[model samples]
Target: MRSTFDFQPLFRSTIGFDRMLDTLESASRVTSIDTWPPYDIVRTSEDDYRISMAVAGLTEADLTITQEQNMLLVAGQKSEQDEASGQYLHRGIAARAFRRRFELADHVKVVSANLVNGLLTIDLKRELPEEMKPRRIAIAAGEALPKAMTKQIEAEKQAA
Candidate 1:
């Protein structure tokens, strides 16, 4: 007797995203074991996205944001003086070293980033080509036909 696993389908079905499967697979491997510096991802528009990280103790000079290949990297490291003088009875804020990466889609570009009230906001916008934009086409009637066809049409019009 054959095992139950033998009845499984040979090939799985994909909706339409064959290329995105690799991205999805890679994303699944990212285990959420580190939650020191929390972040949020928000979709502002159809092609606009924003990433906000709660970096209260991190200054602009301490943070670095860059795009390498297709990944957006955000890292930070506090100054040595700040680490030495800052004394806390119960320290909960993250001020050591950290790096976070986000995968970007094709043609998606980072517009800008700003730090306000201890929150860092990174904006991204996708720029599509002009040929990819939607267009409309108008159909024209055969109103301005040649005289030969016009004569045949007149003869048929007369016959009718």
Candidate 2:
């Protein structure tokens, strides 16, 4: 037995759906991607965010964080160690090199990075330009008014 799927009707009914198709393709591709050094992304404020990754047994000197072309890349490689004479019975820790990439939005800047308690924390802040912020406009009357009245109005507006 075989099952057939039909998407033409659904696709035709949707409006401005190019983005939807692109998102679907991306999602399908990401599922097969590898997941290592598990991470967490949190929004601390309206324009502030933090990304934490579990990097046990990894030191600051071994890790590298960089932002290139709107993408944040974190990579780590352990240093070579002296040969051990005795054989270990059990070795559970991971010391392998890892490279993790994160897609960042525009205007997002990496503020700082710190390693504490086997975790790597990276802070990011989004800075919007002055023109992007909301502002209030003062409406003036079309007819000419007295100079004293205009001065008084300007002073009151400034005080407000």
Candidate 3:
């Protein structure tokens, strides 16, 4: 059974949240979940993240990683030599091609990707722009405003 949520009420009060709401609604729908080539997502620090995926039997030439806007795509395809290497009595390891997609937040960028020991590790870091970073503003005391106001008040009184 699929449950549908009405976002009319939220739309009336919220602004610039349509994309988030659409993501939530689409995630709620039922679909075939692919679990092949297991992966792990870990947060190393406040602004650093790591994604490790098990891509056994796949070499650097067999994999492709792309970062487009807010999406990260990872795909792997077994080499032709591996498929015709030998006949196995009991086939176990998955050699099928697979594609994975990850949604990245604004300011989050892929730093590097490395393949080692059947594991592909991808590093991510979030770097906010200077204008978006928090900044401290100096507060002025009452006397500071009065000084400027007093000059204006004196000028007006002289004119009168």
Candidate 4:
């Protein structure tokens, strides 16, 4: 089942949240579109993450991972398939091309990707920029306000 949410009413009550709303709406639309080659997104630590994909019968040469802006994409193409000239009673395993996209938050980046034992393990870490990271905003103790600024403050106080 697909979820359809109307965000127009929410927009009227909020500001500076257009990006977030758009991201959520887009995510809801994309989730219902595809479900091939199962994958899992796990948060390992406070700022670390890992995406493990079950890609059995796949190799390193067939997988591609890329990060564009705040988006992470994982695509795989089966380069080697069973080209045998025999008839099989039951064909079950799927070795097909797939493309998976993830909407990553700011500061998150792909640290490394390793394919071990048919599992594509992608590691990610959030390294916030110095300016974006929160720090102490120290207030100067006993510092007097400038004459003009103090005059404006006094005027506002008297009016109030």
Candidate 5:
């Protein structure tokens, strides 16, 4: 059974969250999603992550990984002739075309990808800009003086 949710009231006052809300709504209706090529998302550090997908029969040539804005897309397709030439009694391996999209947070970017022992490991890193990072504000000696003290000093200077 699918449950319907009303997000109108919840998102009425939100800004810059349209895509995020849409993604959440779409994810709730998960009946249409394909479960092939199981994957794992691991956090290596505070800012680094890795996505490992099991793609036993696929090569780097057969897979395509694309990053558009905050969307990470991974897709795979096998040739029809390859399937026609071989017939298996019990085909356990899946070479079917599949597309998977991951919604990345802001500043997240793909670092590297490699196929090792049938595992497609994709490394990702979240790089925060300098302006967004925490910075220390150096206190100026004169700036720290109270306004009343500075006014008194100015008055004293004028009298002198």
Candidate 6:
């Protein structure tokens, strides 16, 4: 079973959210479900995050992490090696190539990545620019306006 949604109504009401809505619609329509190399996303702090993936039988050389714009790509490619000829009773380990993508919020950046004990941990932090941060605006109490504002006000009064 599949379902679809109409975003035309939302388009008229929302502003600067087309990309997010498009992402949601595309994700809903995706038919393939790939869950290999399971990963976990955790918020370590207010602006810090961590992603841990269970990548058994994979080494540092077999994995690649890249960050482009607001997207994070993690891919793993196993090196070609000759396997033992002996027949095994049971083969449980998975050593396959995979590519995973993660969407990042604005200002979020990858800090570091480390692989230890078959686990890959990626750390991220959100560092908002000074202009984007919330600032306190001081209120004037019965004081004269600045020269620029006073001049503009006088000009407007004269024009009127």
The TM-score values for the models, in the order shown, are 0.70, 0.68, 0.84, 0.73, 0.79, 0.79
Colliding residue pairs in candidate 4:
none
Query: After superposing candidate 1, which stretches have Cα over 4 Å from the reference?
Result: 1-19, 30-32, 86-88, 143-160
Decreasing lDDT order of the candidates = 3, 6, 5, 4, 2, 1
Model 5's lDDT to the true fold?
0.88
Error of 1 at 108 (Å): 1.4
- Candidate 1 clash pair list: none
Clashes by residue pair, model 5: none
The alpha-carbon deviation from the true structure for residue 127 of candidate 3, after best TM-score superposition, in angstroms, is 0.9
Model 3 agreement with the true structure over 65-147: per-residue lDDT tens digits: 99999899999998888888888899788889999999998899999999999999999999999999999999876654344
Better of 4 and 5 by lDDT: 5
lDDT of each: 0.81, 0.82, 0.91, 0.86, 0.88, 0.90
Candidate 2: residue pairs that collide = none
Model 2 Cα shift for residue 150 (angstroms) = 32
RMSD of each: 7.3, 12.5, 6.9, 7.0, 7.1, 8.4
lDDT per residue for candidate 1 within 64-136, as digits (tens), equals 9999767899999888888778578988776779888888888889999999988999999999898987889
lDDT of 5 by residue, 4-99 (tens): 676777688898888878878877774775788899999999999999999888888889999999999999987666788866899878888989
Which order, best to worst by TM-score? 3, 6, 5, 4, 1, 2
Highest-scoring model, TM-score:
3
TM-score of 4: 0.73
How high is the lDDT of residue 27 in model 2?
A: 54
Higher-ranked by lDDT: 1 or 5: 5
Give lDDT tens digits, candidate 2, residues 36-117: 7889999999999999999988888889999996689999987666125457688787778999988777679999999999
Off by more than 4 A, model 6: 82-89, 142-160
Q: Which stretches of candidate 2 lie over 4 Å from their true place?
A: 1-25, 82-86, 144-160
| Best candidate, lDDT | 3
